[model samples]
Target: MESDYQSLFQVRLANYDDIPAIMNITREAFVKYQQMSGVEKLAALEESYNDVKKDIDTKVVLLALSDGEPVGSVRVEVFPDKTAYLSRFAVKVTSQNNGIGKSIMNLVDKIMVKKGVTQIQLHTGSKITSLIRFYYGRGFYIDSTDKSRGYVRALLIKEYQKKDC
Candidate 1:
């Protein structure tokens, strides 16, 4: 059976009441990372409703909907310098690999571009080759790596073309 994702999911900015669904998607999405890294408490899995609500107030939180149901989310923090940080990207386990992640990323890029951001940054586990490849395919490159926090993280950056949007 073919999944008709194009006709299924819609993306929109999230609201305060969507925090629980956001956390649920985040938790479900990070499970593989938790099992792979042998870390039981990934930051995404530990986020509080208050934390997410704060993000909703201060940052760009995008939600992907399936039949009006929340199925995925991504958060962005735009800085004073027009550089933005992307984080907590998640798609429900059942919705994975259906272009939901790619769609969210494309939506984020559009959102940042509209905000006049010149670049977007994000960090991921250094050991996660598949994730690195995913970001690479999206035009992000490793700007640096840090291990001082007791785990390796690859800092990736994607620069937007100069445009008057």
Candidate 2:
């Protein structure tokens, strides 16, 4: 089925071939942010080939494609108890502010609802105020801040109480 954001792209589970292009988009976007902050030295930190490989092994990465070109992506790992952990949400810089992020997230919400998930959760750093605010705008609320995967980050959650089918 086509996502409501069909004009923007199709959001789907990532296939192996999409990883290289997904990594390229991620590197380009993050490196651009690094450059704009005059922290060009941090540009090298955007290397995501290995991270992409790991996410693929974990079966968590989702890719968004526009005309067969990689334009956006996010990853989420589902636990047995109907909660999911999301990470690495991104849209190619050129595609930002066009509702693609919201669209991709809405797609995930719907899918998780169907999967019987009761909530979705993720973490963002205090340094990324904009990202936190964005998640808030999407109905996520700050739950807490704690050591997540060795990094101090804010925990945010969005509960899903799907209507009966």
Candidate 3:
């Protein structure tokens, strides 16, 4: 069952040693995103090791591993206003559709909720219907769209309910 496959993945906070795996996964995943979105290049693809290192040092960077092999990664920066920005969410091409992405996202939700983040926002190509649907299924809605990057990028927002303590 899917649950069994999902159980194979373990999500944890990333450290300095994870930078290479993180960079590899991001490049491999975003190269596919570029092809799918018909864009020649993406900022994700241009990120250097230093950029990833900076994130690991300053933000909530998570790495998902399967049987001790890196399979996915995501980064989130929680701000002073109780809002969080999610970026570079990518699962390995071989690991896609196996519940790894969902697992990582569910962990993000739990982490954000614990941090009292009421709203989480991310941007993806607006025209990518499958991705849009995925986010929709995860409780995100299109807050707006912008073409500043030469493509219609949708700003998706997900708001969490404050828990009664």
Q: Which has the greatest TM-score?
A: 3
lDDT of 3 at 54: 95
Question: How does residue 50 of candidate 2 score in lDDT?
Answer: 76
Error of 3 at 79 (Å): 0.4
Q: Residue-wise lDDT of candidate 3 within 1-165, one digit each (tens)?
A: 666565556999999899999999999999988887877769999999999999998899999999889999999999999999999999999999888889899999999999999999999999888789889989999999998887889999999999777
Encode model 2's per-residue lDDT on 42-133: one tens digit a residue: 42355567778878888467888777778888888889998999877778998887777888898888778878889999876644667777
Worst 10 residues of 1 by lDDT: 1-10
In candidate 2, stretches whose alpha carbon ends up further than 4 angstroms from where it belongs are: 1-8, 32-51, 146-152
Sorted on lDDT, best first, the list reads: 3, 1, 2
- Highest lDDT scorer: 3
Give the C-alpha miss distance for residue 40 in model 2, angstroms. Answer: 11
Q: How far off is residue 124 in model 2, in Å?
A: 1.1
Residue clash pairs of candidate 1: none
TM-score for candidate 3, please give it. 0.94
